[model samples]
Target: MITRIFPSVRRLHRRWFYGLMAMVMAVGIGLATPKPSQAGLLDLIFNGIQYIQLSNLSTQDEVRLGRRIDAQLKRQGVRIYNRDPQIVAYVDQIGQRLAAASARPDLPYTFQVVQDDSINAFATMGGFVYIHTGLMEEAANEAELAGVLAHEIGHIGGRHAVNQMRQIALAQGVAGALGVDQSALVNIGVQLALSLPNSRADEYDADQRGFRTMGQARYAQSGLVSFMRKLDERSGARPEFLSTHPDPGNRVENLEAMLESEGNPNATDGLNNSAYQSKISSL
Candidate 1:
């Protein structure tokens, strides 16, 4: 064993020791090398990728979006206002009543009844709402009109339209989206700033809010039920509004059930029916 332990053995041991040292250095270098982190990595792939600007839109932006769309819609075509001054007054009267009870009554809300025989109605952004003459004719009375108007009021007061703008701006980004030119992005924003397309959750919320307003203003909730029933019964000549706001099947049912618990209270009408008839007749 002593003879075997030669200087050559020492040389081999030194070589093996150096090999082990080299292996340790390799492992240390591999451990120290940095790997990619999980955060702020998306920016590398998407150029300035942005998201919904719900909280980003200013009040001015909201109002501007509303006004822009209002103009575009008017340019597309101004709806025929019933010729009868009384009809205009009647709609304004009920609208004011409902607006006063709305969450954002300070907004300059205007309600107009268009001389069209379609069971339809819609609320534009920026506190403008339109009701079809057909819808008014279909309504049993002023309370029903008020109920319908109240629902629209709920939509506006909920800021659903402005919220829509935020959604579009977010999805579209502060830059551009949906193949729209940068110049037309604002236009698309305005057009998309609708009230109803605001999610089923928003619709349900608006429905409840409007119902409460109807109750508070002493408008007959059964008017809402009757109106919904009419909408549900509608078979022919559906309006564009119908295309957007599908019949909330259980909406009226739920409203009736709610009223049942609240004892079906009395309603005081602020409508000028005689004037409405005269105005509509002229149109």
Candidate 2:
């Protein structure tokens, strides 16, 4: 009677263990590469958790993350320029054109001006992109302004922020991520918005994407190349642009190569300085 009862207990334990593993797999957590020592069900549940792949994150999750980051940026004193309807409308128009030409044309892209005088622009997750007033003031023409917007949009299209956050979460040891950590998400967003620069590869990829978008949108393909050359010429002690983007020299080189591949076409068919200037004069 004792032996028969022991066999029944062992069978119960086996069934319960397999059921737990099946549940873990169903939840998409057990797909991770298991550790050699983590053969047992309990160890699999508790040990050596790995990073969640970016593919696991949905587009809605990305938009939510962007909204959180955008909120944090607003709270951190990042001013939004809304006083000039003309400026806002014009920027939005150009941004829409670029987005239409982008790979992810259906994304709800938003382009806004920041009141800062720094020559920098950044894109968080989703389709949010910001350009500083100083960068606008320095742009030679409408094409140049559109070029910057296209570049920022490229960052969004590439989902750079989401990729960055995945790495950030992994580094922070937050395993089994399902995108519900509000505090950690906010902190990561702040870091991305205020301090972290995208990798050089990311910067180059964005540049290429922007270049293609500008070409397809009938804007001057060389506009970004010219902008990078100007930045390289006048790069003094760390400028805001350099702080968040790749070096001007490398960017210029890459853009020049791209331009060479696609020979010069007619320049941008967009607004002239007078049109853009009159609109921005309100600032």
Candidate 3:
């Protein structure tokens, strides 16, 4: 009898809840339509739906969303390097180490190398991180490469991509009463990962988080600091990294200060430049 009732309840719950939510969303949109500010109405509706869908998004849901965006990105011509499995595995090993020490360790992190040589790395929600071959070549040591991976993981832990999606949803307005369409959200995410710059606040927050994560993972914090300095020197060329992550004023100085405040403990794990180059020599 219990088994019989459980299946019935499960079926009813899905149908009933989704129908009720859809109806409520529709009514809310209709009532919001006449508000003096169309933009304001849209904002209200989006916020309401976003709160229901994204603010409390389950880990499973977020991961599913990430998979869709990642698939779409591959379809749209993002070349992932498969020429060397060793290089790919090396990155994943470092990324896994950082993710384990990160604030959000439960997430299943994936690290992939892109074939591009433009010196950039990016992460979307659900612990997906990508590093460019160029960025790997630019790093002088293992710690520097680890530093970049930690920073990308930091963005995932902070759910900055979700926040960015919220802003995009607000700006574009919802496409339907149900909310920003899932397919649309995937497209927006691809754009965000590929081209859009994170807010200054997001950049600073990721920096702080990444700095902390690096320390926890026992990588030399100076690696992150030095990498930032390298990017700053290239301010004229404006590397894809700096283009995607707007520099908060005094960023390197701030990181240096953080290192100082922590007493700049001597960490010896990833500072071996020769070892790092040998690991990625195939690239």
Candidate that would win on lDDT: 3
Task: Please list the residue runs of candidate 2 whose C-alpha ends up more than 4 Å from where it truly belongs after superposition.
Answer: 1-55, 177-180, 263-267
lDDT of 3 by residue, 160-239 (tens): 99988977887888544445667778988999999999888788788888888888888999999899889888746778
Q: Local error of candidate 1 at 46, Å?
A: 28
Count of steric clashes across candidates, in order: 2, 0, 0
Residue 171 lDDT, candidate 3, scale 0-100: 81
CA displacement after TM-score superposition, residue 86 of candidate 2 (Å) = 1.1
Measured with C-alpha atoms, the lDDT of residue 247 in candidate 2 is 77
Q: In candidate 2, what are the lDDT values of residues 201-239, reduced to their tens digit? A: 889989999999998889887778887788888845665
Off by over 4 Å in 3: 1-52, 175-177, 263-266
TM agreement with the true structure for every prediction: 0.68, 0.78, 0.80
The best candidate in terms of TM-score = 3
* Model 1 lDDT-worst window of ten: 175-184
Give the candidates in order of lDDT, highest first.
Answer: 3, 2, 1
Off by over 4 Å in 1: 1-61, 174-186, 193-198, 236-239, 263-283
Model 1: which residue pairs collide? 52-170, 84-279
lDDT by residue for model 1 (160-199), tens = 7666655675576554322223234446544643333557
